[model samples]
Target: MVQPAPYLLGRFLDPIFAIGVGTLSYIQYERNTHREPGHTLYDLLQKKFFATKEQTQEKK
Candidate 1:
């Protein structure tokens, strides 16, 4: 159906769009922020992936 096309397009594009936005943000953050131990995207993702909600709350 015609409606399905727009829905499918959105589903496919959302993640791609999010990646672009996140990459741009990460570049800006790295440029402006201090260099810490876990500053790269890989390190940041690892920390976030492994961190518990409580630990993350403590950081914030």
Candidate 2:
């Protein structure tokens, strides 16, 4: 079945909005936390996806 244009647009935009907000939130969180100096956004995201709990806590 063919979906309506608005519904298709909404489906496309939902993830974009969520990712944009989530990225901003993560940047804010990294600023508030004890992350290493001079870390880039990529670094922060990488740590977020890859670092373990103990590793993150160790920075505190």
Candidate 3:
């Protein structure tokens, strides 16, 4: 009637993982609240990754 090592390890680590995720979410919330009115982290990343030719020209 003994559980395997992986199962025991998962049970022990689940709480830690949840806490880490919660902390990251809180930090993201704080950052978003203080950002400029029309921009977000996702928008910045999207513009960086998928900029149009005109957008690129404007930067130069």
lDDT of 1 by residue, 1-60 (tens): 355434534887988988898999987888688667677776778786988888889988
Top lDDT model: 2
Off by over 4 Å in 2: 1-9, 42-60
lDDT of 3 by residue, 1-60 (tens): 998556534886978888888978965995967977547656776798988999999999
Q: Which 10 consecutive positions of candidate 3 have the poorest summed lDDT?
A: 3-12
Cα deviation in Å at residue 30, candidate 2?
0.6
Residue clash pairs of candidate 2: none
Sorted on TM-score, best first, the list reads 2, 3, 1
Candidate 2: residue 29 Cα off by (Å): 0.3
What are the clashing pairs of model 3?
none
Task: Return the TM-score for each candidate structure.
Answer: 0.41, 0.48, 0.43
| Candidate 2 per-residue lDDT over residues 1-60, each given as its tens digit | 998556534877978988999999988898888678758687767798989999989999
Candidate 2: residue 3 lDDT (0-100)? 83
Model 1 worst lDDT run, 10 consecutive residues: 1-10
* Local error of candidate 1 at residue 11 (angstroms): 0.9
TM-score of 2: 0.48
Off by over 4 Å in 1: 1-9, 34-60
